[model samples]
Target: MANDRRMTTDRFFGGVGERLENLQALFKFVDTTEPDKAELQDWLESNTAAKSESTIKAYVGFQRSVGLLELEKDQYQTTPRGATFADTGDPELIFEALLENVDGFETILQTLDNEQTTTTAIQASLREAYPEYQLPQAVVGRHLEWLQAIDAIEKQQSADRYELTSFGKRLLQEKLDQKPTIDDLEIGSTYDRVELHEAYGGARYRGIAPSADYPYVFLFTGDSGTEHGYKDEFRGDTFIYTGEGRTGDMEMTGGNKAIRDHKEDSCELHLFENNDEAWSVTYLGQFECVDWFEEQLPDTDGDHRKAIRFKLEPVANEVEFTDPDLGAVDTDELYERATGAARTDDEATQQTTVETTRTIYSRSEAVREYALRVADGVCQGCGDEAPFLGNDGEPYFEVHHLYRRSDGGPDHPDNVIALCPNCHRRVHHGKDGDAFNQELISRAENVESDSGK
Candidate 1:
């Protein structure tokens, strides 16, 4: 039986020797010796049958893609797989241990039944089981699947669950009687690049490519010409052609012209445009420009005489731009205020300036607090105590703002309601609060009318 096993092992090893040889070449370069790209290229040229520099480079890239090599700072090093398992001092011994413990995967299956175990838990388990080996999760998952394919184990619904199969138990019993050989383990298969590319063709080729039609909001500023003669004084009237449209020429003719004619404090003009079906300009506003133009010039073009230059300059007034559907807002720093925690004189002065000029609020926290107050710390309809509780035993509740942020609802307490997490989730995503409230009102009216009848 031993001789029979030996012959099988020899056949398997001999058949796989060429593929393993290629992998061994990669392992040498990735070893702790840490050869840079040039050294690696030299080694590949001297050792491997690979003829061209491009082929060597391609092989090195393949090794990287397959987790056998990693590049850092132009130097190549063995990945965890190569350093710990594939080319180690006792690679066969380490591989045997992994194969023997295929049933050990039952622990993972058990862990998944209780809760979602993080990748960290699996790594910790591997470290405990094989203190000397550092196996990556990808390698572990691959081995797990191999065990399943051979009917040695079965996986449960949870990623961590595995059950030993009858074939696996029998294999373990047989291995106990005789020393295990490499033939006892399964050899992983490989494919050529063309085969792999063909296999993945459907997934790789099928998809929608994004086009420039995706709508995005942009701000445009008029060009600022050079300091040449009359151009410096007439710079205020130089209408910034925000590629968004020609409409800015007419819309800004009123208030903007006044500032340019009066030569009021250097001013900034804002224009909005849509680039969907057609380029259209929306609204325009002007504010006092408080900074030097030379510092704000865009890097794209030094020639400011162009129709429109995309440049942003510091201004005194605040401007808030918002996307209605996205519920995203961009605001100038005019709303940022200090928290009165300054200790130094300069900090104190800055704090005073900020406090006088800006206002700030924690919108989410405010909404949550308001919701708790409105619900009176209980379920509004069922009067059931909320499930979530604070450390102090206060019923845990979330705040729901009636008008959504996307619809321009203010984050004030008046627009908020206190609700349990379940109720809150239901209100937004389920029956919806407005419809539910109308149904409740209709039921109440029927009850009152029936009582009178």
Candidate 2:
């Protein structure tokens, strides 16, 4: 029972009022992962008043004692209560915890009582009030240090005395009245102002979707009202080909422009839900634009028009969400990083260009060459000869995928076909594109190897 009473005594890191602020700092330091004592000390030196190892030790001990942290081996991690306080940023809850645990810290506050006083004055007052206890000036200074650390009291700009902050006064009043306040409700977040308008029904902004030429962090809002309604069918992590519309000659502007510029190594994509709440713009991590092609899409007037469709692949990282600052990273280096290759100093300085390195699979080149050799200067789709010869003195027909690599298609010879440029465009954008694909599937060799036929 005696030890229990001692445990019940409230103690702050620096002294009475400062522990919560210290707790806040500690939580911020270990936002999602545990760190060692040296790391904590380093963070304190950079972010807080405590600079020495001794001061950080005291602060960490105080936090551990108050159930804010759990030390395992050499690392410190946040307790569930610590996480809650960090997420909510509720000062009152922190204060309540302190009041229940710390012993004589409240006496210091009661004595100061919202007055503008110096540490010298506080010491004299404490001495006068409790002459029998014989509290030292250092103890009084320590308490004042804590109060100041927590911003319960601040030094006046014109005078050398300390005064209570508005937050300090509200805290004191709420404790006295035993009343509670609520947290601010979240509105919309994540989507930019223009995205918000497009997401809602204010106005339809053309060229908003991400494209190959200028890959953007496009939102795949899986909602019923969306133009393509792909969101309803989207499941897990996979590639998507966008519905087409809004075309230009050799260039797509607006959303189409963004997609047109998307390079597999350079573009970025994000998925969000169509929850229609201000705060519901959840970040679904970054994705890679693997491939794109033009497809026929119906315009507003229901007429078929050429539109650019994009294929996206996910970037797997240890962190749950990463909001990369695209401008800070060189576009060339960004692609290199995306493709899992090291960029030398010279390569990083060069202008942004599409890289032809292996990313999803290394055998893609071998498969393409094998399929081209099998075609032997003839377009398999149209039974026509190659339109031209290449520098290698071979037919220049392109290897087309029966299934997209982004959509779990194998990079094998059987799943690929050689096509003339005209037939390639016809299969991707013609009115009978689906029928043409079915025809290829029936005749294409070796495609059934992975399908358990």
Candidate 3:
């Protein structure tokens, strides 16, 4: 009876060992299959002895707690710890091994090959397989998270799908090549001219093509809008003005004779500012104004003879001249001084102070109240009250002189009327004051007649 009891104890220990082995095999399958919980349960029940579903579940939970498995999306996968164990066929030995050598990192490579998954998917799968693991989710998440942060694993937008990154594939290929001194070095060098040409196929090296020539010159002629019927001429390669006025018309014959002489020639007439206070000619293209030679007088009527006179206004930043010789030219400085002098003179002429002090009054409130009473608080222009409503719901209006004081208009209340600011300003400041006043009077008369009715 003593021997039989000892035999039973030994069998009990053997069964416990077998159960542990089965659990390890289950974890290996999860690492390899990366199956969801239900699929894993189905596989375990079919392959193993009659273990209860609850027992399998408890074992799964225990494996997760021990950091041997991971749970993700209701699925189970091998953790890095479990993967290491599977690769070495001994979890305790791998746990004790140092990770200094590249061979120690081979576990990750082997896991990748076994699972055919991205580092992220592998990590996430491990979390699902070991849902109750004491290891922080951050630790399990770090491998994939770091890879993704460094663009070593591709993350899907809204799916659990992941794939090896380009860098990861390159690393694996490099490992397979067995090349010593795998430096993972980037060649930090700029391309030479020939190398760039070869890489881009000499595309960018093609010189910029020349633009087509547009040689058309436009000549504009118009009457000077003066008593003299002489027309003014403006010539340019294009018909656009440079805001410097007509460049070609500053000639003696109003540019007409000069343009006629050089009708088919290409020339530039640069009329720079002369010393005179008005516009004067400088650098006359290739033409010169000839004096009217009285010695070569023709027997012609005065009206038949051509007389040319040109006038140009000094624009901003352009030169001005006061004499015909282009001497005494003034730049914009003369304009500034002249404008300043005029302003100073005007300021000096203004009244220093009125002899009698007049009391200033704002009749805005009175005008607003009176206008609202007269027009029933409506805009006289649009027949609406929207313009008059203040933030506190009071009608707004402005007081205006019936006749402007500038135009001998009285400032008395009798001359004033309650009108919307628009109508008020229009009556005093607009072009048609009489018309606006007439309309106001007509409206007042109509209101009075309605009151009587």
Candidate 4:
């Protein structure tokens, strides 16, 4: 390890119970008055819980070291993070500052990722992380207190043990993950909180983040809507996104307005989908709002309300390419995803978001690969060998869904059959296509049952 390293250390002001509120209080006080050291001590005695001069002195120095406070000439002033926390009382803004300016604060939370740890263990980590500093037990305790105050961590049932709360784990994931480079923002790439916001500047929360600094509006949608009883879905190629606001009729304001006016504002609308990864979302490429409509939906309070659902169309049609490496593709993993992606009309989970398009694409691709692998160049429908070999030197055969693709059927293995082009077009365009397709559906079902689905 390199000996040259930056150290971020905070002193235990007052006691081990030093917390975010104390810093918030100091920030509030300094917004109005440019107080000198004695004046600050007197103000702290009157306005804060700290009355001792020693504790007050420690508070000033600690705040200064953490970039929360600045000593200009002789008076104190709050930095941007400090000022923002003072005005909004939003802990995460302050948490961002702690991430940059306090050691052990983030280290302790990371150490407790899946398990609990003690103050002694945290102190040891701080000692290792910042060898130049004297990180005592009190320093670790104070860091733990701040984390607790911000609801990022909690004390375990055991008196000495501590662990990250759910919020803590998520916060750590977002703050610690590496920001994606420009090339990494592909159509299906996942990002920590944001890849676009950092690249172009926008709100980091809510469904929409309109950048005042740039001509861009970012829209996020997903199955996460299921959590809040809101619905977002993909109706064919159009993504139906429910506007923001959990309760009451959603008005044309904030994120909703930004998305609505994206075209007139000349701001590009970039779409992303919520994924399973904590503090992360998958980029779904750019979309333009073609239309919007109001519908009756339950709010967070479960009350019926009128909400706007925007119909967004992709700016450019996505071309699906057959993977040249399909021979080496993991069929088992693709099978699981394909089978799990059945189209659901469930009101609760109509929130398929981009899954219907993305997952269906996966589902069909997997089934085609699967059926071809099973057929050994023979057509399931016609019971004939393939007419020719493909460009890849593999026998050419097509996978046909029993239910037509236009009907929005799932591409599960049990519902698809390997067919030669003659049989494929016959089922689609022949006068006896319906009966032939029905017979093939039964044949496909039996085939999948006999082998694999």
Q: What is the lDDT of residue 44 in candidate 4?
A: 81
Please give the TM-score that candidate 1 achieves against the real structure: 0.23
lDDT tens digits by residue: candidate 4, 237-265: 45678898898899987678878988997
The candidate maximizing TM-score is 4
Q: What pairs collide in candidate 1?
A: 30-78, 108-160, 109-160, 109-161, 222-240, 371-417, 371-418, 388-396
Model 1: per-residue Cα lDDT over 1-453, one tens digit each: 000001001111112225354555557656746889888877766766666777677656655654557899988887666676555543333234333223234333333333444555755664443332455676466545444544555666666556556665655455445532222211122123222222211111111111011111113221221221111111111222222112221222222222232224222232222212222222232222322222122222333332222222212222221223211222211112111122579866876666344333233332344345446768754557788778967887755555543234344444455556676656545767678544434544564488662
The stretch of ten residues in a row with the least summed lDDT in candidate 3 is 1-10
What Cα-based lDDT does every candidate model obtain? 0.39, 0.54, 0.38, 0.69
Best by lDDT: 4
Residue 37 CA displacement from its true place in model 1, Å: 1.2
TM-score winner, 1 or 4: 4
Tens-digit lDDT track for model 2 on 1-453?
Answer: 001111122234444446566667669678676888888778777766676677678767766776677788988888777788877766655555554444334445655575777767766665433322355666666555655655666777686577777877766666546422111212222445344333221112222343211224354443432344221222112345454333232235444444445454355554444446543444444555556676566544455566556655455421110224322434334333433445577755652464433323223434455567668778999999999998978788877777643334444456678899898888877899989987987877434555543
TM-score of each: 0.23, 0.31, 0.19, 0.37
Instruction: State residue 40's C-alpha deviation in candidate 4, in Å.
Output: 1.5
Candidate 4 residues lying further than 4 Å off, grouped into runs, are 1-18, 124-134, 179-453
Tell me the tens digit of each residue's lDDT in model 3 across 45-122: 887764577777764664565456788887788877777666656523222221111111223433454234654555
Worst 10 residues of 2 by lDDT: 1-10
